[model samples]
Every structure is written in C-alpha cells, then in structure tokens.
Target: MALSPKTKYNIKRILPFGVIWLILGALFLTVEHLALGNQKNALNSAIKLQPDVVLFALTGVTIIGLLVGCIEVLVLRPLFDRKNFATKIISKFFIYFFFFLIVILITYPIAASIEMDISIWDQKVRNRYFDFFLSVTNLSAMIQLGFSLIVSLLYSEISNNVGQNVLLNFFTGKYHKPVVENRIFMFVDMKDSTTIAEQLGTEEYFKFLRSYYGAFSNAIVKNHGEVYQYVGDEIVITWTLKNGLRDNNCIQCFFDMKSDLYKKGHMYLKKFNMQPDFKAALHFGQVTTGEIGVLKKDIFFTGDVLNTTARILGLCSTYKEDILLSKALAHKIMLDNNYSFKALGEHRLKGKAAIVEIVSLLKNP
Candidate 1:
C-alpha cells in the first residue's frame, strides 16, 4: 500500500527530531570518552572502553530518540496544541525528562552488564551501575544530558510554531536572497467575518478563529499545502506549481476543508452560536520569495498572483460562489468526475489592465 502525502509529510517532520537526538548523543559520548577514558573510580575499579559498549550506548540513544519523537508528535503535541509557547516548552521538557530518566535507569544496568560480561542481575554489575550514577561523573553527565534535551525540545517547539518548511528554509538559507519561481496561491477567507466578529465580540471571536483555523488545517496538510500567512480571518496558502497540480491537490484541498468545517458544525454552533462559512480563490503565476524583516525575519512571497487571487476571492460574494479559480489554474488541474467546473467568464480584476478568466469550482453531487 502507498502512503498518503500527509503521512509522508509527517514522517519527514519527525525525522529531524530523531536526527537531532542522534547527533546530541554522539556528542555526549565523545565528551564522556575523552573525559573519563579508562579512569579509575573511588573504588579503584577500572573499566576498559570497548567498541561494543560504545555501539550499544549509541543504539540505546537512537531508540530513545525515535520513541520520544513519536510520543511528542502523536501524543504531546495534540494534548498541548492550544497552550502558549512557554507553557508548551516547560511542560513538554519535564514530561520528556521523566521518560528519559526511566529509560536511563533500565538501559544503564543492561549496558553495565554488557561491559562486564555478566548478568544484569549480578551483584557486581548492580553495584557498578549504582556507583556510576552516584559518582561526580554521572552528575556532570546528567547536567549535559538535561541541557541537550532542552535544546532538542526547543527546536521541536520552534519547528512546530514557525512551520517545518519555514524553519528548514531558514536553516538551509534556501531563500536568503530573492528568487523567482512559479507557484499557486489560494486565498481562503471566511464569509461575513466582520458580522461574526461583532456578534461574538473580541474574546469569543478570537477563540472562534482558533477553532476555525484548527478545523481547516488538517485538509491543507492532507493536500500538501504550505500556509503562507494568516491575516485576520483570511489565510493564504501557497504551493509549488507541481505540488498544486499533482492529482488536483489544490482543488481537493478546498473541498476537503469545506467537508472538515462542515463536520465540526455542531461544535461551532454550540461554542460560537454560529457555523462558519468560507470562500477561497486560486491562481498561479511567478512569485519572488525571500527572507525579509530586520529584528524578526520571515520568508515573504511577493507577486501579482497573490493580489489577483485575493481580488478573485472578493468576487465570490458577487457570484454567490464558495470557491473560485483562475482560468490558468483551472486549465492546469487534472479533475475527475468528483469535481464540477462552471465558467464565470473573463472579468477585469482590480488594479489590472488585462482581463483574467475566472471560474467557479464545485463538488459534484
């Protein structure tokens, strides 16, 4: 069986977590090897440094990393998804640290037994394990381990907060300078946002938007969309031309978002006393992408495609349509019988001399 795009994306996201831990573990091992190479304890017991022991330690750390990454992604993230940044970092750190301690307690004894060529239950191996932890060396090692774990957790938090793609770009300097590329833009805006805001008031409206965005995000992820920005009740999603056109992912994303929102209608009605409706417009063209801002930098996209998409979205109320797409994008998409397209005819978009063709996209009943 083939993996879905969403599943592939998730595995990609979790991979870095494991890699970070593996690197840190190697560094920790190197420091320990150098600092305590064949050193004698207060008991005057000397242990030789063997390749198998080092390999076992690395394997243990790798397993711990993969397990922790899985727990952080599948369990911890969703549990604290709504919490503030500081809260998430602090809470997750302690939780993961506790698990780390448990892993160390179990694995250290086994590692000691391997080095001594004895059963883990042997009295000599038991004494060696306890003595190793009670020593000043273990104190220093624990401090190093704690610091390393905190750093790894921070990376995970920041990656989740800023988005994985954005963080990778920042690290890889992929868009350090402006570069032009063809891309597709989707401007999704909630209908009657002002009315909803006023009806719900400030705090309630903020909560509503959180719920609204959260509900729609899964579909975007499933369809492999990169979120560009969120301004008020409007979210800008962008994709490489190839990614957007593949299997008609761009169009499918909009419909999937609608279905997801509809499924959560009861929750919305109960919480906000209203169900949210939205409109989206899609367009494709060349855009210049680069890092921008001084004190705080971000990957910014600049192009007429974005403005054109927003303008097309503005016409949604006029046409009484929920989803609209440019003729260029519509032509590029490979649609099946599940989708229906209606020609809304070419129209003069705002701040443009040339008329652009537009069409409505609908799900077939």
Candidate 2:
C-alpha cells in the first residue's frame, strides 16, 4: 500500500538530509586520501595506499552513510512529524546523538587495531585497522551532525509551509461543495445557551461552547456528514440519502456525538459547574446546494427542506423532544433498522405552506 499523506510529506522533508550525508561521506574519503599523500602501500616508507584498500574503505563509508540516511529519512522524520516543533527538534537531536555514539563505538575498535598513537604525531603513520575505522566513523559522524542541523532547520521551514497551505485552503477554497438535490438537513442547537453563558461568564462559557462544538463537529465529520454552518449555539449539518446519509454510519455518528458530549459535559460540570443540553431537528426533501457568496464564500443549502428542518427543531421546544425528524427521514431510517419513533401527525410548519409529518426519536431501551 502507498504511504499516507503525512508519511509522504515527512519523507520529502527529510530527503535533503540523506543527500547531505552522501556528500559528506564522499568528502571525507577525498580529504583522507589527500592527507595520506595518496600512498598505495601501508608498509612503504611513504604512506602507500593500495587502490583496492582505498576502494574498500570508501565503500564502507558509503554503506554507513547510506544506513544513517535511511534511518533519518524513514524512522526519525515520521516520529518527529507527530510532535510539536520543540519536541521534534529535541527528539531529532537525541536520535542523531545516539547514532553518533554508535559510530564512536564502532570507531574505537578500528582505531585501536590500526595502532595509531594519540600521544605523538608521527606515531599516527601506522595504518592500523582500528585507526582507519575510527577516522572514517568520526568524520562520518561530523558530517552527519552537520546534515542533521540542516535537516532540523529545513523541517521547520517545510512544516510552516504545509501549515500555511492547509489554513489557506480551508479558509479560502469551497470545501466539498455538495450537488443540488433533495436530502435531509439537521440543525442541532444547545438549549439554554444564553442562560449557560450568563452563569458561566464570558471566558468560561466560550471555552465550554468551543469544546461542545468541537466534539459535535468531529462527530459529524466521522459520520461523513458535512457541517455547512455554525451559528452561535446551532450547527447546521446536511446529508443526502443517496450519498451523504449511510443509515448505519450516520446513526452511529449521532450516538458517538452524544457519548462525546456526555463525557465532555460531565467534565465541564465538574470544572465550571455548567450544564449543556442539545436539541436537534432533522428533515428530508429537495434542496439546492453549492458555494455561495463572493467576499466570504460558504457552502450552503437553500430550500423548503432547510426551512422545514429548522421548524422541526423549533418543535423540539414545544414537544419536549431531544430529537425531531420529519416523516420522510423517519421513513428512510426505518427501512434500515427498527428505531422507535412516535409520529406527531401532520402539522403546519412556520413559513411552510403545507403540513409536514414529524416524529420524535425514542430511546432504544
């Protein structure tokens, strides 16, 4: 399977670090060869580097660098992406340091085998296995550290770019503009919002509303429902029977929303001593939908269906019902499963010319 968008983005972001590592590895080989006077024989009076020996050493450096690059690109970047900037940076630092420590561990043995003395300058002329390994590992680590710093900086830049693009698109673009068709629209409003606001005060009440709205919105998204608008205490959601409304999924979504609200409401009650209740009205029928407006555009539905949904919501107050659905919606839902609903008979809705059948959703028990 292909990687998720998040994973792909992280891989792209860390690709530069891999390139840097490869470059540094190549440079270390160059510097080492030049410093040793390009000698072919280690036993010669002059430092003689064998072509085969040099090739093998360079190959080892290349492989080590490649491994480091793969780790940085695949493992480190993905882990870092999930965290905040400061945490990500700290994590990258520690991971890179750990890798450097590994390089040191491998280098120490190689340096000892080479018999390279740390105390004197000419004593380092002995081309021992330990010395060769230490030199390459140390240089590779230095190069890796430099690349890590660059990657850390680049990661920040790329993250900012992604964040800005997402915000720009969300605020500006027409999001999932629905096709014009008859469908069910539900508007759920918090009961006694003004009184709750007054009791909780401005800041506390606003926070409560935010949490409540956030939970509901997330539920709507989970149910594959589109939230067209959020007006104060009310959230207007739209779902098509043909496409948007999946009986099992949509019903499950509402249950999930209630569960989320129940948990959150109890938390708020304990913390701020505030009680929040919800009332919803659902109606199904023909409606026109698309992106509307020029300066500040929004995707909206307009028709008798929307009007009827609002009226049904208003009836919640009179009927003492938590949720009220139109006959059309109730009929459709009944086709899927046995959900108890009490019919309220045909009644004239405000602003509606004809009478509409309404039903009260009953507890499953």
Candidate 3:
C-alpha cells in the first residue's frame, strides 16, 4: 500500500539520516579494508569493494533508518506528548530494546545470505548456510551495530522533540541574527479558556491542553503552518507570505484544527468533561526572524506584526467571533468560493492612533 500522508511527512523528516548512515557504512568498509594492513590477497581486496557488499551495507543502513524513523514518528511522538518525564524515559528504554532487536532480525538474515553468496562466488570460501547465519549473529558485530542503532534512534528522538525545521535552522544558522521578512501569523487560543480550566481543575485541564495542542499540530502540518511560539493558552503559528497565501492555507488551517478537535469531542467529554473550541486571528506583515540566546539558542520572531496579530486575536472575544482577519491579509488573496467574508469596519484599536480594517471570514452556507 502507498504511504499515508503522515507517514510520508515523517519519512521526509528522516531522509537526511539515510545519508548519515551511508557515510558511516562507507567508513566502516574503508576501515575494514585498511585493517588488513597489506595482508590482502586478490580475493580479500575484491571482497572489500564487491558490488554485493556495497548493496548489503547500504540496504542495512536504510532499513535501520526507516525502522527508527517509524518508531520515532508513530510510537515515540505520542509517548512524549504526555507530561510525565519519568514515565517517558522508563517506557522508551524497553520499547526501543525490543524494537531494535526486531529490526535486526528482519534485516540481518537477507544481508547475511547475500554475503554468503558473495563469498563463495568471489573468494571461493566454503561456508555452510548455518555458518553464514552464525556470522551474522556474531556477538561483537551485533553489539556494535546495535549500539549504533540505539544512538541514532536516540538522536532522532531529540531531533523530533526540537522540531524538524528548528533543528535545521540551528545547524545552518539560517537566522543567527535578526532578518526582516514578510510572514503571516495566526494567533489561536482556546475559547473560554479560563472558565474551561477552572471547570476541569488544574491537572485535568493541563492534559486537555496537551491533547488539544496535539490535535492542532496535525492540522498545522497538513496546511504547512510553522509554529512560532506558545504563550500561555495561546499558540502563535506562522508562514512565509507566499506559503500563507498559496491556497488560502492560513485561513484553512484554523478551520482544519477546529474540525480535528471537534472529531475528538467524545473522548474529551469522557475524560475531562469538556471539549475544546478555539478562535483565531490572522494578519500578514513584515517581521524580524532569527535565532537568539546566549545559553540556549532558539529561533524567534520579533516585529510589530507579531504584536498586531496578537491584538487582532484579542478582539475575538470582544467581537464574539470565531475567525478574524486583518484587512491587509484579506486583500492580498482571491478567496475561494467556499469562503465568505463580512466587513467588521475599521476601528482604532487600543494603543494605536490609526484605524485598521477588520473582517470576519466564514464558510459559505
């Protein structure tokens, strides 16, 4: 079967790892060849660069990558979403142990079979099928390979936690210092957030928030929204101007998040006795984007646009509206027919002398 969208996205996130292990595999081959120290006969040298060996090494690397990637995305992603640090550490230890062993079992057999064939064909070494299997199960090799797999998998867990793009920017220094760029910001917060938190009590309410954000994450990725910050009960998501306007993605991401959470209403009601509903405010403008920190670096946005977008969302409760958009953002696009808009009229927002036009965006009846 073809990969699901989520699977495809996770795989895309893990693609660079394939090259990482490919390099390691090549290095391992070079080291092994050099370890022979001029003792190599023709067959030994030939065995070192054999096409079958290259395929075996690369294939093994790829299988380990996919195995670790899938585990990180499908299994560990949800596991880390919970608030308990102690439980996560304990659970991951056992989970990874068996999972990596299973990966070894599935991949090693085929590789070992290939190596046996290559040996007989090229070096005229006679080895029984069982001997090939035994070589694959060699204690030292398995331990070293398994250690590498565990280390790589653990790195994946950390990378996933920091987020894919955030890690990239950290290494590439894409925004080491502030740089101005046009970005669209969507400020989304739970409706009646205070009342809901009180009703659910502190612990349950936090869990609700976690689950709610988890639901929102899927929709944001589906629409290509990049999350900038989470302030208290609100989350600030952003996009490049082009990406935000490409297919009305900024507008659609809000509704999609709502739909996802709505579908989980029953589960929320059963567990927390409440379901979440969120309101969003959107605006497009210039912002300074870059990484900042002395001890712990992080990618951050700074500009009036960020402040203005927050103020737009601050009006949602005042206007009693679910979706609000700045006139500047609305004017840039030819909205699809599925959407309808209402002019909220220009208003002089607090702390601003000039009036800013606003609109309510809604689905067509």
Candidate 4:
C-alpha cells in the first residue's frame, strides 16, 4: 500500500537521525581503535574491538537511532512541538539519555560475548561487560554518544524550524549568490476571508485560519510543492518547472487541497460556524533566488511571475472559477484525462502591457 503524504514526510524527517547515528558509531569505532592503540595490551582484552564487535556496534547504533527517531516522531513531537527549542532539546536529551543507558546495558553483554566466544548468559561475559562499562574507554564513548545525541537533537529542531529543503540549501550555499531559474508559482487566496473573519471574530478567526492553512500541508507535500510564504489569508506555493509538470502535480495539488478542505468542511462548520474555501492561480516564469539578510538570513524569490500570479488569482472571482492558470503555463502542462480546461480569453492585467490569456481548470467527474 502507498504511504500517506504525512507518512512519507515523517520518513524523510526520521532518516537523518539514523544517518547521524551511523556516522557517530563509525567515528566512535575509529576513536576507540586509536585510543586502544595508545593504551597497554592489558586493557585491550577487557573490551575487544574485533570485526564482529564493529559490525554489532554499527548495527546497534543504527537501530537505536531509528528508535529515537520514532520516539521523537510519535511521542515527543505532538507533545512538545509548540514548546521553545531549549525545552525540546532538554526533554529529548533526557529521554534519549535513558535509552542510551539501556542500550549500553543491553549491547555490552552481547558485544563482550561475541568477542570472548561465549553466550551472553555466561558469568564470564557479565564480568567482562561490567569491567568494560566501568573502564575509561566506555566512559569516553558514553560522553561522545551523549554529545552526538545533543547535536542530532539540535539539528532536528533547526531543520524543522527552517524547513528541511531550506536548511539544506543554506548548508549547500545553493542560494548564496543570486541565480535565475524557471519556476512555477501558485497563489492560493482564501475566498470570502473578510466576511468569515467578521462572522467568527478575531480570536475564532485565527483558529479558523490555522485549521484552514494546516489542511494545505498534505496536498502540497504530496505534490512536491514548497510553501514560499503566507500573506494574511493567502499562501504562496512554488515548485521547480520539472516538479510542477511531473504527473501534473501542480494542478493535482489544488484539487487534493480542495478535497481535503471539503472533507473537513463539517468540522469547520461545527467549530467556527462556517466553511472556508480558497481560489488559486498558476503561472510559470524565470525568477532570481538568493539568500538575503545579515541578522536573519532567508532564501528569497523575486520575479514578475509572482506578481502576475497574484493578479491572476485576483481574476478568479471575475471568471467564477476556483482555479485559474496562465495560458502559457497551461499549455506547458501535459494535462491528464482527470481534468477539463476552459479558455477564459485574453485580459490586460494591471501594471502590465501584455494581454495574457487565462484558462480555468476543473476536475472532471
């Protein structure tokens, strides 16, 4: 069975944890070998760093990493997602520290047994395990593991806060210098937002918007779209030209989001005494992307396409359509049988000389 979008996203989020642990495990092994080389032969027998020991350590560390990831995803996230970074780090460290102790207690015996060619239940294995655990080598390894866990937790918190893609780009310097690239933009604006807010009042309207915006996440993730910005009641989603065209993801995202909100319409009515809806416009053009700001850096996209997309979104109410795409962008997309398109004819947009043709798209029943 295919995984849900959220599941896929969670997997992506959890993978880094496993990778981080694997690297740390290898590093620990290398450090152990170097440290053992410096120590007397008498200490080497207490904690053997054999081939089997190496494989077992790496495997155990990876499994522990995945378990830590699951704990964070399933338990820690929902409980402390809204908390401050310090609080999250503190909580995660303590929880993972407990697991770390459990791992050492359990894996040491098995590792020792494998090295000594005896069953873990044997008293010799237990004696060796305790000796190793109390040694300075184990103490050093434990300290390193503790530090690695903290680093991993910090990475997770920052990656989540800045978005995985954005964080990667920052690390890779993909947008440090301005570069122009063809990209697709979708401007989704909440319909009748002003009226809804007035009816729901300020506090309730805020809650309504929260639920409404949250509904877009799954669809956007499934379609490989990145949320560029949220402007009041409107949101800007963007994709690379290739990504937008693949499987007609850009168009499919709109329908999926619409379906999701429709599914949640009853909840909105129950909680806020109203249903919220959105209209979107799609356009594609060249845009310059770059990082800006010294105090707080961020990736920024600047282009006429964004403004044109916004203007096209404004035409949605006039054309009586929920989704409108520029004729240029519509022609580029290899639309599937699931959708039907209607030409909305040429129109002059404000602050532009070009008369651009527009098309309205609908999902066929």
Candidate 5:
C-alpha cells in the first residue's frame, strides 16, 4: 500500500525532532556530571550530588525528551506528509511553536523546584543554565524542521521522477510484461496517419502523436483497459472478457475518445492542416501474452485472435466503418439499453480458417 503524501511528509518532518531530543537528553546528563565537579573520579562526583535531586533532574529531562520525540515521530510527521510547500511551511511553524511551548511548560516547574533563580544565583550560573536549556531545545527543533524539509523535497523529486519513468516505460513498450490469459484485444489506428505525418513534418507530427496517445491512454485506463502498445499511429488495448466485455465499457471508452478527439483534433489540424481520425477492431478469444525477446523486450499477444483482429481492421475501408467488433463481443454486450450494434454478418477475414462475424456499434441506446 502506498502512503499518502501528507503521511510521508509528516514522518520526514518529525525525524529531526527525535535526533535532537536524544542529543539534548545526553547533553543534560553530561552537564549534570560537570556541575558536580568530581573530575578525579567522575562516577564518584556524580554520586556525591544529592542522589534524589540528581535522579529527579535526569529522569525529568529523559522523560520529557522521550515524550517530545515520540509525539514528533508518531503524530507530527504523518500530518505534514505530502502537503504543499506553503501548507508544509505553515505546519512546521505551528509544530515548532507547540513543541517549544510544551517543553517550556514541562521544564519551568523543574527549574523552579531546584530554586534556580536569576536574581539569587551568580549571573554566570543563571545565564549559563537558562541559555543552555533554551538553546538546546530551540536548536533541536530548528534542526529537525530543516532536516525534514530537505528530506521531503528530495523524496518528492525522486518519486515524481520514478512515476514519470514508469509512465514512459508503459507507453514505450519497455515495461510491458504481459500476464498470459484469455482476453479481448482492441486496436485503434488513425486513418491517413502516414499522410498526416508527412504533412506536419517530424517535430509537429511527433507532438500530435503524443497528444493523441495521451487522450487515448486516458480513456483506456479510465475504462480498466491495459494499453499494450503503440505501433506508429495505432494503439493496442486489451481487457479480459470476464470483466471488460460487459456493459459496453470498451465501446463507451471509444465513444469517449471520439468525443475528446473531435473537440481537440481541429485545433491540432489548424496548425498542421491534418485532421485526426482512427479505425478500431475488437476481437475476443484465448491468447498467450508475455514479454518477448532478450535484448529488445516487448509485450506480444499470440494465437489466431490477433491475426483475425488485424483482418477485421483491413475491412474497415470496405464497410465504410470507423469501429468494428466481432459478433462474439457484440452478442455479449449489446443486450442492454446502454448499447446498440449493427450486425455486418459473417465475412471471410484474410488468412483465417473460418469466416468471422463483424458488427459496428450504432450508438449508446
């Protein structure tokens, strides 16, 4: 399970507080030993200090530090995880203020109990102890906050980079290691893609492809479809029949893409004078899917199902169709009010042993 950004940020923020607490606790112990001034034998010197007072002071400092550290690590860190920079800065300020206030409240009584008074004690002694306590607490808080911010920034940058790489690999066919199973395969290929590419020149054509891929990929993912590959101006999308062929989600996804493209394609064409359009083929059956090759690995689907889908795509020009689905898909999905499809009857798909039934969706009923 992924941690929420806020939770991760919070953990990073509080880590410094924990380190500071430990250091301050250790400093308190060392200071107590020195104040007693039994350097000939430090242990003996420590023992000479009123045992009860020594124990109380040490115990108080340790307990306070432990409490503060625990709160920071457990409660504070999680709250700031993944927050925006402005929010994070505000959160840090509040956390520091609260921590400082709590520490002062806890320690002031202990100071009073020891009868440590600025007016009564020598200026050096009073100033030294007061300054030491305040400095240690404040320094610890500041260090922890600074460390947390740096860590959070680094973490965010790293995560963003990783996510970008994953998305890139996904589209580029580098990270596609297909899990073998029976599935419905759909391929959408832009019509006149070569002419569009030729007309636009290389850079603008590549930009158009990226934008087209983005829109199509969004639709596929939204419909729980896995986009397997992009071959030139074509995209291959796959989904399990058990889940994907019901309620016409796959068809709906195409319509959504059409609507999106119709709205955006014109703007692209205005610059390039090349309208974007596509033809799609959907087929269902058993197929083996996996990564192929050793050096240049790629996800591949094997068996007659792939060949037949390709043939159906070839018939798009003959039938004057924009989208084609096999009878198997249309039969399973077109029963409900949400879908309607027109049967084109059985036709001999090239290089196929049997004639395949094809259909085109009319509209969402």
Candidate 6:
C-alpha cells in the first residue's frame, strides 16, 4: 500500500536530520583518524595510512541518518502518540532496542560498499570494524541527534506561542495600522458559566474549561477560523469573508464545536460531574484591524460590529437559543437548502439605536 500523505510529510520533516548526523560523523572520524596516527595496532596503522577517511565519514553517517530518519517517521512518532498508556510504554521499549541494533548492523555495510575493502572478513579487519562501531561513529550520530531534537522542540514551542500565520503576518506587515476588512465574527460563551463554576469550585472549574476549550480546538482549525481571543469562559473566533463562506466553514464550525463537546460528555461527567454547553452569536461586517499595544503588542479589532456581535450573544439566553446570527451574515451565506434558519424579527438591541434583523439557526433534522 502507498504511504498516507501525513506519513510522507512526516518523513520529509525527519530527513533533514541527516545533515546533522553527517557533520558529527565527519568530526568523529577526523578525530579518530588523527588519533590512530600514533597507534601501535597493525590494523589501525594501515587504515590510518589510507586516504579513505573522509569517504568513510560521509558514507557511514549517511546510513546512520537514513536509519534514524526512518525510525522517527515509522516508529517513534506512532509510539509517542499512542492513546493507550501501557501500549505506548511497551512499544517504545522494543522499538528503541531494535533501532540501535539495526543502525549498528548497517554501519559496517555502508563502509564496505563505499571503500570496497575485500579483507573485511579477516580477524584484524573485523576487530577494527567492531571497535569503530562500538566506539565513535554511531555514538556520535546519536549525540548529534540529541542536538537536532532540541532544535526541533524549540522551534515547535515558538510556533505554538505565536501562531504560525500571525507570525508570518507580522513579518509581512499585513496589519500595521487600522485597515478596514470584511470579516466574519463569532462570540461563543459557555452557558451558565457562573453557575458551573459555583458547582465545580475554582480548581475543578479551571480543569473543566481546559478540557472544554481543548475539545473545540480542532473544529475551529478545520473550519478555517482563527481564535481571536479567549476571555474567561468565552472564545472569540474570526475569519476573512472569503474563507468563512467557503464550504460554509463559519456555519460548520458551530456544529463541529457542538458535536465535539457532545462527544466528550461522558468523559467530562465521569471526571468533573458536568460537561460544558455553550451558545454562540455570529455576524459579518467591516471592522478596523490593527496592531495595538506597546507593552505586549496584539493584533486588535475595533468598530461597532464587535459590540453588535456581543449584544447578539446576549440574546441567546433570553431567547433560549444555541446559535444566533444577524441577518447581515445570513444574507451573504449560500444557504442552498443545507440549513434551517428562523427569522426572529428586527429589534433594537440593548446598547444600539439601530435595529438588527436576527435569526436562529437550527441543525437540519
């Protein structure tokens, strides 16, 4: 069977470790070559007399890199992410044990193929091979791999701390000043958060929130939404108009978040005695977006659209609805018999003079 796209991508990611292995392997071989210049051993003396030291370093580390790369892509990643605790521990133990043995066996073959040494089976030659394998080459590769691993971890941490797209936008200066852009906004708040916190207590409530938000993360990403802010028990998600309407991503995002939390209901009940339920209000309009703050800068959004969005969210509890949106957003979407929405009539919301036509969205039964 062909490898999956995810596996192919992972293999490409790991292949660059080969360069680190090659550099370390070259340094280790050069040191050994220099040290052997004074060795009394006949085999070491003869091998040091040869001009193939650089050749050996390049070939041997290439093999080590290839093996290590395969081990990471095919074995370690799957083992590390195993959902079952016992299986993860047991599989990792055997995988590492087998990994070291395979790398060692491949080392000498790579050397012989590149150097074309015919006396490779002789006692002196075999001893030298065993000594080199046990002493420097593979050991050097392993040590250099630790450095590569650290770099990879640091890079991932930085990317996560500042979102990948946000970092790119900063460098590109996409929002240097307040610029008007059409955006779709969703203000999602946990239902009865104050009551839930009172029932669960502070510590447990925090844990509950952790699980609750974590569950919705995948849905938001899959639906092309950027989490604009996370306040107390609410998450504000936004998207460009083009992305929001594509495949009905904005609408699908709500259903996906609802389904994600619904699926985790039993787990939440078992641990925390309650699962989080939320209400959301979505609207689409022009908003001014800019980089704001001097102490710790953030890309900020302003204008009446946000206030209108918050007020729409306020109507949820009063109207006893799970999802609500202004007609502004509804009018732009391609409904096409895919969803059901009911007109709630035009009303002047609490903080605004102008009336907004709102609607309640229902899952098509």
Tens-digit lDDT track of model 6 for 145-258: 455344433333343456645655675699986789999999999998999999999998988888898899778877878888889999999999999999889999999999
What C-alpha lDDT do the candidate models reach, one value each?
0.85, 0.64, 0.75, 0.87, 0.65, 0.74
TM-score of every model versus the real structure: 0.94, 0.54, 0.84, 0.89, 0.54, 0.66
Index of the highest-TM-score prediction: 1
Question: Candidate 1 regions off by >4 Å?
Answer: 37-49
lDDT of 2: 0.64
* Model 4 root-mean-square deviation: 2.6
**lDDT, candidate 3, at 198:** 85
Write model 4 residue lDDT over 193-241, tens digit each, in one string: 9999888899988888889998988899999899898889999999999
Ranking by lDDT: 4, 1, 3, 6, 5, 2
Candidate 4: residue 36 Cα off by (Å): 4.4
How do the residues 1-365 of candidate 3 rate in per-residue lDDT, one tens digit apiece? 96754666677676756655666666666775676566364232123445786787777776666666666667685667554655665576567667656665555444544656653334334333234335533453456555556556556656767777888788678898778999999999888889998888899888888888888878888888888877778988999999899878898888899889999999998998878898999998888888888898788888888778788888998899999999988999688889988999987787777678999998986
Tell me the lDDT of model 1 at 53: 81
Error of 5 at 46 (Å): 24
Instruction: Compute the lDDT for candidate 4.
Output: 0.87
Cα lDDT tens digits, model 2, 15-72, are 5444545566567557656766634433322223445544544555555555655675
Over 4 Å off in model 2, which ranges? 1-179, 335-338
Candidate 5 segments exceeding 4 Å error = 1-180
**Which tens-of-lDDT digit does each residue in 182-227 have in candidate 5?**
8888889999888888878899899888788776745665565767
Better of 1 and 2 by TM-score: 1
Better of 5 and 6 by lDDT: 6
Question: After aligning candidate 4 to the native by TM-score, how far in Å is the CA of 328 from where it should be?
Answer: 0.7
Better of 1 and 4 by TM-score: 1
Task: Indicate the residue-level lDDT of 43 in model 2.
Answer: 30
Q: What value of lDDT does candidate 1 attain over all alpha carbons?
A: 0.85
**What range of 10 consecutive residues in model 6 has the weakest lDDT sum?**
41-50
Q: What is the lDDT of residue 219 in candidate 6?
A: 86
Model 5, CA-based lDDT: 0.65
